[model samples]
Target: MAPGTAERIARLIAPLRVKPGSRVDLARDFDPRYKGPLKKKDSAELLAVGVTLLAEYQQRLAAQDTYGVLLCLQALDAGGKDGTIRHVMSGVNPQGVKVSSFKVPSAEELGHDYLWRYAARLPARGDIAIFNRSHYEEVLVVRVHAEVLDRQRLPGDVRTADIWERRYREINAWERYLTDNGFRVVKVFLNLSKEEQRTRFMKRIDLPERNWKFSAADVRERRHWDEYQIAFSEMLSATSTKWAPWYVVPADRKWFARICTAAVLAHTLTGIDPQYPTVSDKARKDLLTARRELEAEAPKGAAADPYAARHRSAGG
Candidate 1:
């Protein structure tokens, strides 16, 4: 990557990152509709470039088979998490990428620890895994609806005071462990404004094609918008560690959000600096020998002349 390009992308991403140990008030610290310093057209162009770069980087990462990348996306309804995944990751090789969309846990999933369902979905070395929603839901949604926790059947002491804080600490430690094991966790929160969410919901109702996306339950959850916001703010503040920080991306502008996501992904992969593995000296020698053998077997001049050979063989 060119220095200028790297610097430009870094600038675009810097403000969005929730610094570790800093409190973040979503309303005060981020604008859900922000498009940064670029015009729409410029941003789109940069995003295209970023997509290409991401694909290249992913190829290198896969070929190296040394590190894994995990992208966890969190957002409220109509927040564009699906769109971001579709567009931003469109350029990557499917074989090298795995996407997991977490919905309501099944009986089997609930039987295990909250993170158990997610652990199996994590990327292996040289692959990228995306979580449409993740373990954070244990804190965000489960916190918003405390009753949901009652079913977990945890020890009485584990459910007592400071449980949320304890979860945050656990998450931080878990992410640090992943980093130590060569997995880079990129956490993205698509910050959508309530007004924009309302507009999107209205669109879902008005457009027949999008009608299926509209759910009465989503509207019910909208009533807890303030609670969700507080939950998100606290979550961001607590878990945005240096090893696995959170990027609070603006989602009102889908194009800009996609661009920002691609940029952040590109930056993270570049930071990992994956490279194609070097061939061993013996392998190199064997490759050269194989090349020479294939070269020696190349078709002779008359065999290569297909038209002439056909005529000669036919006695023409």
Candidate 2:
């Protein structure tokens, strides 16, 4: 993490959280004085701070071999989950990061249990896993269009009213399970207003390159926007636990939303207080012995070429 790289990263992510014509007041939620673009200096400063904290988090994650999760960017269409991931995590160590994007389930997927893939996708110890859109879909998409669930033929004992409640209880217990086992869960709902989504939809239609983003089905879903919101709000209220809290991000102003998200994430990671594992004295002595032997037998050209070095990475 360079002096200002974190800030620049923050600027890049800022646009993903909120766009113009947003129904929510994101800037005001963070600070009413915040206006348009995040200046280079400010963004740079933010990134510097953000990266330092993430480095600490990465160290702690590795040392403790703890798993952490960033879950459920639950929002309407164009809520900026992709953007948030791209920008907010730019400062993180990619080696320990895994991202999963959940979409419409295939026939085979429908046949198995809903949690099947989710369980397999869980990050291993010492890793961070991000869910672009997650299992919450079972609640959101299923509730809005029962047709989707009808295909799966849910358990006969599952009642209509009890289904969602069961999920919420399972979600909270699951989060607590993770925490007790050394996992952290952070759920964020990108709360964008209908007005903002419409503006972005129109942008996709009007802009030549962005035209591909528009879909006729998206307009159809917009009609049920109220239903989705109620489901989302209810989900947030019911599942916002002490172990895993849900943050309500204002999705009106993209920059403000990005900053606030960064702030919150930074806050969470910092709370983990990760520290790099210290090398043992025995290991240090062994390294010194190896270094002495290497130095004694080393040739001038023993060092590798820079160009060849570029192709191979430490991860390999």
Please report the candidate that would top TM-score against the real structure.
1
Flag regions of model 2 displaced more than 4 Å: 1-48, 297-316
Give the runs in model 1 whose Cα sits over 4 Å from its true position: 301-316
Local distance difference test, candidate 2:
0.70
Candidate 1: which pairs clash?
none
Q: How do the residues 1-316 of candidate 2 rate in per-residue lDDT, one tens digit apiece?
A: 4465545544544433433223333333333223356563576565556656666676677677755656556668898878877876777778888899988888888889877667668777778888888878877888889898788878778757688888878877877888888777777777787778888999999999998878999999999987886786567657767677766766666655666566656656656756666789999999988777766675676643444455675546
lDDT of 1 by residue, 211-294 (tens): 999999999999999999999999999999999999999999998899999988998999998988999999999998987776
CA error at residue 129 for candidate 1, angstroms: 0.5
Using all chains and alpha carbons, the TM-scores for the candidates as numbered come to 0.94, 0.78
